[model samples]
Target: MMLDRKGNNPLLAIKFFGEGIRWLGNSKLRKFVVIPVLVNLVLYAVAFALGYLYLGDMIDRLIPDWLQWLRWILWPLFFIGFFIGGFFTFTVLANLIASPFYGMLSAATLGIAAGESATVMEVPWLRVVKAELRRAAYLGVRAILLVIISIIPGINVIAPLLWALFGAWGMALEYLAYPLENAGILFSEQRKLIGSVRWGALSFGGLAAAGLAVPIVNIVVAPAAVIGATLYLREIEKK
Candidate 1:
C-alpha cells in the first residue's frame, strides 16, 4: 500500500528521523558514534589549520597588489578549503554514523526483495565499511562530479541545491549497500540494486538535507537523516 503523500510530505520524513534516533539509543550505539566523532573533529581541526597556513602563503605569493580587488572575491573562495575540510569530516563520519543503521536497512531491503528475514549485526564498523567500499567510492566519485559541475558559471547558481541532494543520495546509497554486500552480492550488482530505485532514493535524500544544515543539531541530525533515508527506501520498495 502506498503511503498517502498528502499534507506534511516533508514533515513525515522527520518521523523517520525520530525513529532512527530511538533505535540508536536503544541499541546503545552512542559508544560507536563517539570514537568516530572524535576522529572527525581532530581531522577537521588539522585540515583547517593546514588549509589556512598553506592557502594563505599561496595566495600571498600568487596574488599581486594591483589585483587587490580580487581579494574580495578570492578570500571567500579560499574558504572553500573549510568547506572541503567539512566535507571530508562528514564523509567519514556519515558512514560511521550510519553504519549500524545501514545494516538494518540492508537486512530489511534484502528481506523485502527476497522474502526472507536477513540477518544484520548490531556492532557494525570496519566490517560494514569494507562491505560497502564500492558504494562509498561511487558516492565519493559522484559527489566530486557534482562539485565540478557546480563550479561552472551558470551551474553555480544551482550548486547549493545539487550539493545537498548529492550528499543525501550518497548517504542513502551507503546505507542500502551495506547488508546486500555482506550477503555476498558483488559491488556492481549492489549498485544496480540501488540504481534501479535511484530516483526514489535521491528524493529520499533531499528530505534529509535539512538535517545536514544544522550546526549543533547537525551532529544528531546527520545520523537521523540516514535513518530517515533507510525508512524512505523501505517504503519505496514496498511499492
Candidate 2:
C-alpha cells in the first residue's frame, strides 16, 4: 500500500483504482458498496431512459430549421456531450443523496487501510449535511459558469475539453471529500491536498470519469472510487 511520496506517477492513481475494485470483493466492504450501486443504477437508468425518449426532440429544438442540414454531424456530438454531462451531473446528485452511507464507507475503508478494526466513526449528521451542501454549492456555481461557456459562440469550441477536465477534477474532489472530511480536513484543505498531488488526482479522477461513463461499469465505479480515494488519502498523508 506504500507509494513513492516524491514520485509523479499518475498511473499510480489507476493502480489505486484497481486496488479499490479488488477491495470491493472483501466481505467487510461489500455491504458498503451495494447501496450506492443500487442508488446509482436506478438514477442512471431513469436518466438514460429519459434521454432516449427526448434526445431527438431536444436536438431538434436546439439546432433550428436552417441548421437541419447539420443534424447528421451534430446528432452524435450532442449525444456524446449530453452523456458526459449527465454522467457528472447525476453523479453529484447520487453522491448527495447517498452521502451518509458514503461517510460510513469511507470510515470503514480508512480503518481497514490502517490495519485497524473496521468501525464507523461517529460524525455529526448536521456536519455531514453541511459539508455535502458546501460541495454541492461549489459544484453548482461552477457548473452554471461552465454551461454559460458551453453556449458561447467560438469560445465554446473548447467546451468539451473544458468539461472533461472539470469532470475529472470534480470526481477527484467528490470521492476524496468523504475520506478527507472524515479525518477532519475542511473543504479548502481537501482541495489543497489534492492539488499537491495534481497529476495523480486528475489521473484517478479521469480514470474514474471514463469508467463511470460506461454503462454497467459505472454502477460499481462510485463505491470503488470511494475506496480508492481513501487509499489515496492514506498514501498522501504519509508524505
Candidate 3:
C-alpha cells in the first residue's frame, strides 16, 4: 500500500520504511543482504578492535588516578562515541566497497516490485566490478568534498546541520540511484523530481540516515534502502 496523500508527511516516510523492512523478509532478497552485512561486520570488528586497543589506552591515560571511579561513566561514554563515529565512518566505507552488490540488489528489488521474472542478465564479472569501482570513486569524491566543507572555519559552526541535510539527501540518492539510473534519469532530473515532493523525500532520507546510526540494523541498510526507495519512487511515479 502507498503512504498518505500528503507529500510532506514524515509519517508517510515511516510507513514506507515499514514496507521496506517487510520487503526484506522475502527469502530471495535475504541473499542480497549477506555480503553487505559481512562487509559491515568486518569493518565494525576492525574499528572496534583498534578503538579498544589504542583509543582506549589514550582515554584511560587522560583520566586522573584520583578519579578512578570515573571509569564507570567513561567506558560507556567511549563506546557511545565509537558507535557514533562508526555509524558515520563505517557505513559509507562498507557501502562503497559493496556498491556493485547493491546495484544488483536494487535491480532485483525493482523486478520483484514490478511482479516480473528477474530482469538481471548475466554480465561479465569484470564489467560489474568496473561499474562498481566508478560508483565508489564518485561517492568517495563527494565524501571528500563534504569533509572539506565540514572543516571550513565559519561554516564549521553550521556544518553539522549541513551534514545532516546532506547525509539525508545522499541516503535518498544512493537508494534511488538504482532505478533512476536504469531509467536514464540524470542527477539533475532526480533533483527536480525530488523537489516536487521535497519534505517526503527528506523525511524518508532522514530516517534512513537514522537507521545507519543504529547498530545491527545498519548492516542491512543497503537492501532495506532499496526497498524503501523503490516504494517511495513508486509513490512519486503515481503522482
> In the order shown, what is each candidate's alpha-carbon RMSD?
6.5, 4.2, 4.5
Prediction 1 TM-score vs. true: 0.58
Give the Å shift of residue 55 in candidate 2.
6.7
**10 residues in a row with least lDDT, candidate 2:** 1-10
lDDT of 2 by residue, 64-133 (tens): 7888888788668767876677686788788877788888888999889878988998778888778888
Best by TM-score: 2
Task: Estimate every model's Cα lDDT from 0 to 1.
Answer: 0.56, 0.82, 0.71
The list of candidate 2 runs beyond 4 A from truth reads 1-8, 50-82
> Which digits, one per residue and each the tens of the lDDT, describe model 1 over residues 1-239?
22223312445444555665664453334544454445445655666678778877877899998986887887688675566446545655556555655555445434433455444445346666665565666667877888788889997899887777777666556544554444555566766666665555555455445444443344554444444445554554435
In candidate 1, position 224 carries an lDDT of 49
CA deviation > 4 Å runs, candidate 1: 1-14, 21-27, 63-72, 88-127, 140-165, 179-200, 213-221, 226-239
Best by lDDT: 2
**What C-alpha root-mean-square deviation, in Å, does candidate 3 show against the real structure?**
4.5
| C-alpha lDDT of candidate 3 relative to the true structure | 0.71
| TM-score (C-alpha) between model 3 and the true structure | 0.75
